[model samples]
Target: MTNRIERLNELDSYGVLNHKQDEELNDLAKIASLALNVPIAQITFVHDEFTFVKANIDVVSTESIPGRVKRRESFCHHSIKNPKETMIVNDASKDSRFINNPFVNSDPHIRFYAGKPLTTPAGNPLGTICVIDNKPRNLSLGEKQLLDILSKKIMAYLNNKRKLLNQENKIIDDALRLQNLTDRLPVGIFQLDKSNQNNLRFKFLNKTMKEMCPSVNTNKSSESIEILFSSIYPDDKNRFINHLNESFDNLSFSNIQFRIKKGNNCAWFAMKGNVERRTDGSKTFYASIRNIDNQIEYEKTLEQIAFDISHVLRRPVSSLSGLVNLVDTKEKLNKKELLEYIGLVKTVSTEMESYTRKLNDIYQKKKEIITNHNKSYT
Candidate 1:
């Protein structure tokens, strides 16, 4: 639970204190002044140091008088002191608190005051809407009830205004957070509207996405999906589009491996995304694109090594095994045949050695590619 001062600070957070006078608030004060036939009706906001007038209406005109007085002299301050209830002084001259008060003893010569405490939904008293009279008087029960109801309306307006301000701030914060998260990620994130296949539009492209394909224009709606496809190699672009459409139609996940044209160079990328069906029967896709040139190259190198082992080395190894079996079966082979078998085995062993050198060369190249790629990204 917050005390009076703490509650005042929370009220201040809404920025309503000492603000430009509102005509609407002034009109409410006018209505109160007219109904009660009082000289002055005010909507006041109380702070630790002062009671500030938000709306002040006289019986003749509903014009606001904006100023502040010390908290001790403020009638609204006493209203807020009592929680959840209006404070009334039929004759301030007879009250002990106001007996020696400057406002009561001097200018304005306050003699009568009746105030309903304005409160937040959490029951924190903000200030009051009260009427003041120069002559000692009392408010009818009907007039007091009207003031109470008017005070509640004023609080409702303040609460609604605060909600709108908070909502606007939350939207701004969310955008900044989204940008921060995407900017730090290594992979590019994107969103594309496929609602109209003929006019596939780029809905969003984060910082990484912009950097990944510098050639593609990032302007939303204006930049078509063709601009993105243009960055991709011609041979792979069609296949990529086809696979994406298939995924969209099936409402399944999309995975695409393709080559992107980067100026004079080409890079391999792996892209994955999912299509979201809109309530209007339209669809959008959110995706990530990662530069996988190094990964793809390394995989290709491994495949080549496997191919050499199974095809090139396997043939020679098989021939050597057959020759060895023939030699073992023949108990007494001729010297010429034995020498020929030994020569054949040497040839087969040299071929296998060549395959090993090829594999080693591929591995060294793959390692250099990986190291250089990492440095480029970093």
Candidate 2:
């Protein structure tokens, strides 16, 4: 017995068992029947439980079953067992192996049965290309040779078809995988037309990017560009436009960060891009946009802290230093001077403590905000 799993897999590799790919095979079957002078001819594929007929010529079909048959009942089943040669029964009624077969004894009443297995290059048998006749007959040497040649032609056609189908499947798989991978990224990725300064047409936008700029429309390039430029915070608008236009002209890009006005709120976005110019002088800009709002807010908090330390803490720190210097210089200070200096020292310490507390509070709030922002992305 053949390795049933490998045989089934070999049959599946053809990719024609489930659908109708028999237009060419049907023509081939017709050619076989005409050349062999048989009442019926078919190309079949056998799986685990059923024998599927891909192409047939003049085979009778009942409404209940169509052109398929149980695997055990098919003449092609027996034909598949011997992959390298034909199984020809010139007279089925007199043959011991098939005398009680339903197809042999009833319906098509196959008295003459000749089948050549449809085998793969790996010696796995799929099914058969066979001829059937109601009367007993013998095939001449020339007729047998013709059948061999036709079977080879059928296999050649099927192999070529499988190659094309696999190639198409590969392309579709690659595209879907790339799309899924890009959609899951944290940054928004896109492609835009860079043929001219006025055109801002988007050629492609990943899912993240589509959600990022919901207001931008692909169909209206110039209008969309206007909207984007208008949305930019006025301070950075001109600089952003200049850099983008220069990048388009130079076919190189540098990083830039700007704020985009989103409703009443704004977001800080950092953009990095590269330009691809095709040989046809057409150009496309591929870019990634990352939301850096948290980073911007954190930086602002740090700057505020620096400003406070420079302005608010400087006065008390300088006052404390001067008080210490004054005490050090006067070795014979009077009681009243000692008392005043002590009071001044206490007041400066109190002011320093208050400022330190305020700074701590500011740091704590900013730290919590940044921590929460980072957690959301993870």
Could you tally the backbone clashes for each prediction?
Answer: 0, 0
Q: Please identify model 2 stretches exceeding 4 Å from their true place.
A: 22-41, 57-73, 91-111, 132-136, 149-180, 191-207, 210-249, 258-264, 279-281, 321-343, 376-378
- Ten residues in sequence with the least summed lDDT for candidate 1: 57-66
TM-score of each: 0.69, 0.73
**Which lDDT tens digits does candidate 1 get at residues 169-201?**
899999889988887889988888877444577
> What lDDT would each prediction earn against the true structure?
0.82, 0.81
Task: Specify the poorest-scoring 10-residue window by lDDT in model 2.
Answer: 58-67
Q: List the residue pairs that clash in candidate 1.
A: none
Question: Model 1 segments beyond 4 Å from truth?
Answer: 1-5, 12-42, 48-63, 67-113, 120-123, 132-137, 152-179, 194-203, 215-230, 233-253, 310-315, 318-322, 325-331, 334-347
What's model 1's overall lDDT?
A: 0.82
Name the candidate that leads on TM-score: 2
Residues 178-246 of candidate 2 have per-residue lDDT tens digits of: 878988998877777755445576766667664555565534433445645766777889999899888
Error of 1 at 27 (Å): 7.5
lDDT score for candidate 2 against the true structure: 0.81
